[model samples]
Every structure is written in C-alpha cells, then in structure tokens.
Target: MSAALDQPAAVRLSLADALRSARETRALLVGPGVLGETGRLFREQFPGRRAVVVADPETRTVAADAVAAALAAAGIGTEPMYLFPGAGLYAEFGYVTRLEASLCRHDAIPVAVGSGTINDLAKLAAHRTGREGYLCVATAASMDGYTAFGASITHEGAKQTFNCPAPRAVVADLDVIRRAPDWLTAAGYADLSAKLTAGADWILADALGAEPIEPRAWAIVQGGLRAALADPAGARAGRIEAIGPLVEGLMLGGFAMQWTKSSRPASGAEHQFSHLWDMEHHVHGGEAPSHGFKVGVATLAVTRFYEAVLACDFERLDVAAAVAAWPAPETEEAAVRRMFAGTDFIATAVTETRAKHPAPAELSAQLERLRRDWPALRRRLQAQLLPAAEIERRLALAGAPTAPEAIGIPPARLRSAFRRAYHIRRRFTVLDLAVRTGQLERLLDAAFGAAPASTAP
Candidate 1:
C-alpha cells in the first residue's frame, strides 16, 4: 500500500499543517537524513537565537555532536554544550534544577539531544528560564514526550507533570532511531500500543459522564494507531519502514496532548499503573523499569480487566443497591490512607480520591447513566481494544516484556496496584468502573488468583 493510503486520514496533513495546528510547537521534520536540517529548522522557528545543546554523554556521541556541527554550519552561534551524567540518569527534579542553572547563565535556546529524560529536562528548564521554547533533536523512538506538553518529573517522591511547552521545533532522523538499541525501539512500540487501553478508558469515562471525549484530540492519537503498530517484528528489526510509522504515531500522541493541554489524550489507566510504580520506587535488578515496559504490562492487565467487564450483564445492574453500598467521603479517605500507609503519597492519594468520590445521589445518577449507556459503551470499548492475549503477542514481537514478573513486579503486588492506582489519579478509568460496581475484588481474584484485601466498598 502507498504510505499516504496506509496512514489514517486525520494525520495525512502536511508537516507544516500539523505544526500549525499544534498549540505551541511550530515545526517538525521527521524523516531519514533530517538531522542536518536542525540548524535551519531552529533558525526558522527562532531567528537570531543562539543555541545550547543539552545531552548526556552517551547521546553526545550518538547525535549531539552532529547537531552542534549542523548549527555551526548554519552560522548559528552556540554556547558550550551541557552534558549530564549518562549513567543512572532519570527524570528527577534535581536534573531539571541543574539544567535550569546552566540555562540561566545564557539566553540561548536549548537543543535537547536525547529521548524522554533529556527532552523533559530541557523542556522544564527552558520554561523556567523564561525562554519561549526549545528545540529537540530526537535520537530514539523511545516515548511520545518528544512533543508533548508538560514534563513528567519525580519531585518530593511523587510523579508530577510540571507544566511546560513542548519544543518549538523537533527534528527526528529515522537513521539514528532505527540504529537505537533494540530495547529502546521495543519500548517505544509498546508505549504506542498502550493507546489501545488508553482509548478504551476514555470511552468508558465518556460513557459514565466522567470525562467527555474530544473528537479532534481523539483523531490525532487514535486515527493511525493500528497502522503504526501493524508490524512489531519490523520495528524490532530496526527497519525504517516500521520505525517511521512508530515514531509518527508517538509524535501524533504528543500533538494530541498539546491540543488538549492534558495527558488524557495520550495516557489513561495504563499510565496510572506506571505512576504508582514510580511513586513506590519500584526497581527490578537494581534498575527502574522503563515507562514503556511498565505500561506494556499494565495494558495487558487492563485489557483483561476490560474483558471481564464486558462479560458482565450490565442490563440488570442494580443501580439503587450499588449507590446505597457506595462508601461515604470519610470512609473512602480512610481506605486511601490505609492503601498508602508509610508512603509520601498518602496525602496526595487522599486528595485525588476525594476529588472523584461521588455523593450517594451523584453515584446513583452515574450508575443510571452507565446502565442506560452500557450496551453501546461496551461496543465502543470492544472496538477500541484488542484481546489481551493479542496485545501480549504484539508486545513480545516488539521485544517488550509481556509479563509483570519480567519487569520485577510480582503478581501479588500487581493485584494490589489495581486498587492503589485508582486512588492516585482522579481520572476515571476501568478501575473506577470496577470499584463503583463492587466488581473490583472479584475481578482481581479472577485475574490474579485470590488476594486477601477487599478492593471495593
């Protein structure tokens, strides 16, 4: 099939049009051999601006040097590149502070020359230093944060999204990305695959009147998801043909987030699992799992939970009984406290849980709406999600870990996460659905054997 024909209609717009539609980003060049145009692209976006390249030692060898050379060739003045430690670097606030210090010393725009961590650091630092926006030189097809607004940074033992604009311009060269380590490419593919569960969560939220779906933002992320994820094997083999769609899908997710000014467009319940892990300081083999790896496993778990939900006969739901059984505000807060005991996230969890906790009347209304809308909502969710086994198959083909154990999460711990994750985010998802209907413990028992804790009121 022709490339244009293979792409979803929503993303067939020219690059210029895509950039113009973005809220903050203005330019994007994604193709093989686009790295050399970095200087020209930055110049077009911000004229007469000096550049400062930010990279880790590893990325410096991979693409930063070439980026600096290109800027010099274009006669764009540059400050000395700031390099962070390559080893054990993560998206922590300390790195952002250090980068901010470096940026504060000069008025030059930053050119972030790495993947997720590098981009987030430069993004927040640039925003803090009062720069309009920075440029991004992507070295891998790792995550969708390349053009997404807000940096996911760990601060005060919680994973927080610090508000920040995406890069003014982004240049992603497929050659460099295709050459990235197999795990990195696999991680990106898995992250992109998460849109399946994310979309289903959005559909569920919309059905329950929790959060209405945004059609434009939806199209931006979901239009081309299947096509982007069609060839996991090709992505694993590092073929540009496969890498191209993968990177494009990841970028489109960011654009969707930028348009909505929220991560809701790109993240959902799957991300909640990842966030919970981050907050808990989950590490396997003395290393934290990549965001994509955690989400990949969470996607599989959420998909199975959706299957269980789909099998239920919602037509006979006892709305009045469910509403009467709902926990009061204080009862829910106490549960949140117990769930997050001995953690810094207890206060935050209590706050978020309260935000979504509904009164008896409100719960009744929502349950009525759910019972009224479930037939169609189920169809929408079924259409949005693939089978859990199929998701695992694709993730395995793409080289991502398909099981929680592979990423150092015990099966028992994962079951606990299903409930704890709900308290950490006010976002309505399948988790909330299970909780409200008193099906959470049953579903958890079915999915991961039996656990001692009661998850639903």
Candidate 2:
C-alpha cells in the first residue's frame, strides 16, 4: 500500500468539538493573533480572576509579554511569573514545586505562555495547588501537552508522569506560531504521528483482554489524523496552512487522553522510548532529544516491530513450553536494575516493573488468551498501524529524525532501551506483547541487527 501523501487536511477537529470532548478545557482560541484577546477572554470566562502569567525566559518576550500587556489593557490584574533563564529548565519536580509556590504566593490563575515545559509546570502546579485547571497561550506548536491531562515530571530522580487536569483553555496565535522555529513545527507533526501506533497498542491490549479501548477517546484523536498530517512539506516549511492542522491534531490528542484519564490514547511504546531517554539524559551529547523528535523515531521502530509480529507464524509457538520458560519476577526485577544501573531513574523502572510483572500462572493465562486470539489480534494491529516506512518517509519529509542514530542514541543504547522500555510503565505495550510471544529478541535483532542474549526476558 502507498502512503496517503496527497490527502487533503481533515476537518474533524474544531475548537468547540475538542473542548466539548475534554469537558475540562473550557475553550480553545486559535487563529491569527489570538493572544491579543487573552485578557478579555480570561476576564469573561474566569470572572474577577487575576492571572499569574507564566513563561520561561525565552518566551517572556513574544508570548508572556503579549498576555500580560493584554491583561493590563483590559484592566485585569496580572502578576507575571518567569522561570530562571537557562538551558536547564524542564518539567521536573523542582520546577513544579517552584511554580506551585508562585501560584500560591500570587493567588492568581496560571496563564501559561510557552510550549511543553511551561505548560506542564503550570498545569501540574494548578493541580497541586488544588485547582481543577489552568490556561495556556501557546508560543510554539511543539508538543501536544497544551491540553493534556497530566504532567511528565522527574520526581525522586525518575521520570514520573502524574495525573493532572487539562488546561481550562488554550490560546494559540497563528501569526506568532508561524514565526516559531521550523523544527518546532515539524516536531508537532512528528508528535501527532505517534497516535497511529498508540491506537494500535490500545487495540492490541483490548484484543488480548489486558485493557479495553475507549471508543470516544480513540475517535477524538484517530479520526482526523490523516487530514491533519496531509502535508509534511508544508509543516517543514512552517506554513500556517499546514501548521494549523498540526496544532488542531495535537489538541485532539490531548483531549483524547483527557477524556480517558490515561495516556493510552496518545502514548505507548513510542512514548516509553522517549521517556527512557529523558530519564537517561545521555543522548545528543547529553542534550536530551525533544519529546516529539525521539517519539517519531521510536514510533518507526515499534511500528516495524509490530509489522513483523503481525506477520509471524503463530503455529511455531509451544504455549506450555513458553510459559515454563517465562522469566521469574525476581529475575525481571534484577534485569531492570542491571539495565538501568547508574541512571537516576532506575527507581521508576524498578517500581513499575515490580508492580506490573505478571506471575507465571497469570502470564500463562495471558499467553493462552493471546494464542487463542492471535489471528484476530493480528488483524486489528495490521489494520491500525501504518507502515513504518511511511512514518519514516513523513518524518524525513518534515526534516525530523527517523532513527536512533539521528537523535544521538548509539546502536548499543537503542538495543538496551528496547530491552527495558516496557519496564518503565505499569501498562501493557507492544514490547510486553512481543516478550509474551517469545519473539522480543528476534524483533530487536531485526531492528538492531543482533540477537543479543541480554534482550531475553
């Protein structure tokens, strides 16, 4: 099958429809120069509200300043909040704590004025401070966290994603967004592409009885994906025509996760790969890859793994023998520690693995179910997943990285990461499925070109 390279952008996403789906996100103001009306919207929507406008040093000029000025023009009180300027700023525990303090001190609603990090810090701080939601004025079409219902924060030196509320509203000014770095726009497209594999993973879990797919949540994201990503070249060129759809697609991803109260609709193994790198922090010469960039590459990797699995010969399996060979809980735990040794986030890996590792009997049952349903499961995965090469083609067209090497993840680390990626989350993923089928090492060998014994579960 050929890629849908020339399809027109889909129109399934609308601000009103998306807001209705997410219930928590009251409004989404998107268009040219929407930031100029942020104060009026804030006052009208959140009557008598004073805002603590949040931004990092970089966005303080273009985004935060406009929000503050607009609020001032509308005679609404504003206390601007700025993170200390540095490359070190991230959505981690320390930043969340500091932002929460600012919210408490100012006694104002958080009006975020940046992309991923700033938005995550603001939303999580609002939740920690007991607010149901906050607002965001997007400076760039970077990641899909603007209206997402959680925060990826590093706590206890581990990348821990905590449940939080979605943004009360999102304001994206197309004029300002068009001026953002082309890479950020391309990253937005790259991020939304993960939904293809994410939905496939959800379908696999649902098919095998590990988890049920949420249809409403799935529709919110999966429906318009094709149209949203119809023009990778346009996105690469930073054209508003293409970038606009990308933003709409990303917002829908957030709403899907919000409706389900889980990341299953927008994350799976691809996200685990990105999160693993965040915790490890050794890529790109110790400069962490952008969430979207890493996910794009990992999405391709996992998609390839899925394609092979979907086509594998299930008749070759000896279910009873495989069950007998399943790794012990203690062995998996030891492996987790060994794989993540010297890493700050090893605790998270250990915690999730211990909590999620199935007992031998349980594994046998799941494997039995999987074997019974292999044909149906295979059909569902094949239907849901796009070709890995199509994704690679799209990312390359958008000037995004399509491999581990492109993101500074050496071949050895890629192998190690794939071996342990499933341990980072207490949720089922393709990695878990592959391990269950006793084909994980084979799949990894295909991706990494070696049957490393260390990858065995």
Report lDDT per candidate: 0.87, 0.79
Look at candidate 1 and give me any clashing residue pairs: none
Where model 1 places Cα greater than 4 Å from the true spot, the runs are 1-18, 156-158, 452-457
Runs in model 2 lying further than 4 Å from the true structure: 1-15, 80-88, 92-105, 127-132, 155-158, 344-347, 452-457
lDDT of 2 by residue, 376-399 (tens): 667666767778878889988987
Clashing pairs in 2: 10-227
TM-score of 2: 0.88
> What's the count of clashing pairs in each model shown?
0, 1
Candidate with best TM-score: 1
Candidate 1, residue 357: CA error in Å?
1.0
Residues 1-457 of candidate 1 have per-residue lDDT tens digits of 1122222234443345456658988788899999999999988988999999999999999899999999999999999999999998999999999998888888999999999988998899999999988999999998888999889998876678898888888999999999998999989998998998898888778778898877777777887788899999999998989999999889888888888888897899999999999989888999889999999899989888888888887878998888878988998888778878899879889989999998888888888888887887777777788898899899999999988999999877888888899998999999999999877888776766677555332
Report the alpha-carbon TM-score of model 1 versus the true structure. 0.94
